[model samples]
Target: MTELLDIFRALADPTRLRIIALLREMELAIGELAAVLDQSQPRVSRHVRILVDAGIVERRREGSWVFLRITRDGAVGDTIARAGEWPYAPREALVIAHDARRLAAVRTERAAVAERYFAEHAPQWDAIRSRHVAESEVEAAMLAMMHNRRLGHLLDIGTGTGRMAEIFAPTARRVTALDRSPEMLRIARAKLSGQGLPVDLIQGDFLDLPMAGASIDSVVIHQALHFAQEPDRVIAEASRVLRGGGHLLVVDFAPHEDEDLRALAAHARLGFSDAQIRGWFASAGLLLENTETLEGGTLAVKLWLGRRRSDEDQPPVTQEGQGQRKRLAA
Candidate 1:
């Protein structure tokens, strides 16, 4: 069929295939897609239009910008699977090698673009931080949950800029802000210290926190869980530091069909769904008190509120064969 041939022709190019791979996980604006492909905007747009006409990609408008993502068509999936088997002969290997080099160069350019973006925005992070947080209902719910809790020693995991910590410190006796980035910690320290709040700054990984067991009365993680290399281990660490009856508040974007975030953010997994967060909490010896979906339109946020049970009441982790009861100690 002419349509089928169009699909094949669109995918025959290495650049179009790379775009398909990127769109398989996350929807991207045309400019963002262009940046990733290291191609001119017009060239990327033309390729995307070809793929769209072939029913392999779909476009949606968000405000003035248009986003592209893979179509949810079985035929498209089949086409992709079949295309995976294009046998490249020895001569074709040279072309593949050339393309590999080209892709590497493109990645370097994209990385430079990302670096410039972060660098430019880093200075004004505080001014715009609230805009990002305030836009989400999940953030609001998490803030309300923290407000209602009788927090004594609060620990904010991945506390970039101390935004959540500064918010919690006035109500809690003390707030400890932890982050892996020294630059981010410096910004957080400046923000929290400038407020004259009782906030302690620590630089460390969330999975391997420097805090002692049962040291914190509350733990808050805000839009940062997806960036963790080991989310389960980080949750376990949060459980370990939480005192009995302590609360854990998590706010993050719900999992979308985006694979690019998984690759770009070093995300071990896509953002958590409600069921996944609940399971993680149960495994960490924490009881789920509430889970809610915050309406943020296309950027849906999920909030999970959990409480640690009494230390002795925690579940036991069973070994595969030994049948030994290893307390699910965080």
Candidate 2:
């Protein structure tokens, strides 16, 4: 009863209601909310705090910017989620319509900034792409591999420019795009907004993911593992978060003699080999299910599909199982 009253109190204000409406459309920063509301930043933050304390809003920080969205959990969140369906008074309707127009302007501003960043970084990305098979071909192959699988909770590690998250969001129950670079996440936020799916952009390291164990149903490390100083640790961390039978798809370069990439692109490793990847998978208790190789230009890209071994997939912990394990170790 107290919680219900707190929720009602949070929504009792006009500005708070407007903020909720805007968030329902897409995630917005406090500054964006202020711009839409024609209020000062401090005032908007106070309203945000009220909603957050009521469990009606959530705040996610990526770099210096904090993004706000409607919370999609619990009974209060579900009830407030239906605010979009509630009939508003004539004045409320007009105000919402006006806010929607301002929201469009905010979206335009975000797009312009994102475009500038892309233009500045396009050459480096283009150089790498020029050396690999066409991105379309790579994406097609990935789709075919994941076509029949359920992408329950998809995590895209090192989600540079959010391409993988954007590509897989439609099929995923929830998508989390994580990157170490805040600039890249900003660019990704611009790319993944309003995709009609719940996409969360997080600033995090792949070697130590900020997720609980066995929480993810699928993971995609797309063309990003070569940047890792310890790719094996990255694989191990990914496996830790995967549920039983969950999938991990790694798309990266096959072993190559590209020394220039090391200096020019900040690549920690030149490329990877089949034996190295298979060994890493086995060490992490994952089974390598299938492999696809795409060759073009000077570099070749390989996709290794691995599945986490469930208890059912493992031998029972019996005397026989111990002997089998001993033999495998030998």
Candidate 3:
């Protein structure tokens, strides 16, 4: 009862309630929240602290920036939703409507920042894009491969330009795009935010995904695996988040002698081989279902599609466990 009281007390304030309503729309950093609320940073931080202490909101630190989102555990979210059901002053709605307009300005600011970054790095990106097959053809292949199944809770790993998230968001039940670079995440956020798609852009490492095990249905690592020094660990991490029978799509370059790419482009590996990827899939409890190759300029792109093994497809116990069970029975 005391805990419930604390939650109510924390939410009793109009500023805190407004914060919750804005968060319900999308996750925002302290600065962005302040911009939308038309409040100072310190004041917003105090309100955020109250909400955090009450366990109604959670904060995730990415680099130097901290972002806030409504808590997703248990009935806490439902409780907040219930509170929103209560009658409020008519002006509250109008205030929120005004906030929505301010939010548009914030989005415009984000796009401008992202555009500056893209303009600065356009040459590098264009060089990389020229070596590979046309993105339109690759996207078509990807769509056809997964069109047969529903992408429940899709996770786009290393979502660079947010293209994959944009392509798959309409069909996915839930979309979350993760990238290691803060600048890239901002670029992705700008592209995804305007579409009215509920995408959570997270700044996180691919080797250690900030997601629970067996929670994601579809995972895509498109043209990003080459940047990882330990690609096997990345595959393992992707497999870890996949539910039974979930799909993992890896689109990257096949074997090549592109030493310039490693020296100039920051690529950890020149490319990958079919045998190596299959070995990784087997070790990660994923079955290699399909493989497609697109031959283009100097680099050839390969797509490996793997499916996580379901419980019905795997043994109930390991060999050692089974042996121990037999000895105990005897």
Which portions of model 2 miss their true places by more than 4 Å? 316-330
Instruction: Give TM per candidate.
Output: 0.55, 0.95, 0.89
Candidate 1 lDDT over 1-330, as tens digits, reads: 887787788788777877776655344568877766667999999989988988899875533556576765577777664543667566655655554554444445545554665687765554423323344455457677666777999999998767888778888998888888766764564444335677766667887888899989999988788887678778889999999999998887777765655554455666788788888899998999987776534456778889998956755545653343343332
TM-score of 2: 0.95
Report the C-alpha lDDT of model 3 over 1-330, residue by residue, as the tens digit: 877888899989989988888887667899999988989999999999999999999998778888898987666777876755767789987887788788878888988998898899889888888988999999998988888886999999999889999999989988899999887877887777778885778889999999999999999999899999999999999999999999999999999997889876899988999999999999999999999999988999999999999988876798999899999999
Give the candidate number with the greatest TM-score. 2
Q: What is the C-alpha RMSD of each candidate to the true structure, in Å?
A: 18.9, 3.0, 3.2
Winner by lDDT:
2
lDDT, residue 317, candidate 3: 91
Q: Encode model 2's per-residue lDDT on 149-253: one tens digit a residue.
A: 999999999999899998898888999999999889888877777566578888899999999999999999998999998999999999999999999999999
Backbone clashes in model 3: 0
What are the Cα lDDT values of the candidates?
0.73, 0.92, 0.89
User: Which residues of candidate 1, in runs, are more than 4 Å off?
Assistant: 1-119, 122-138, 262-266, 311-330
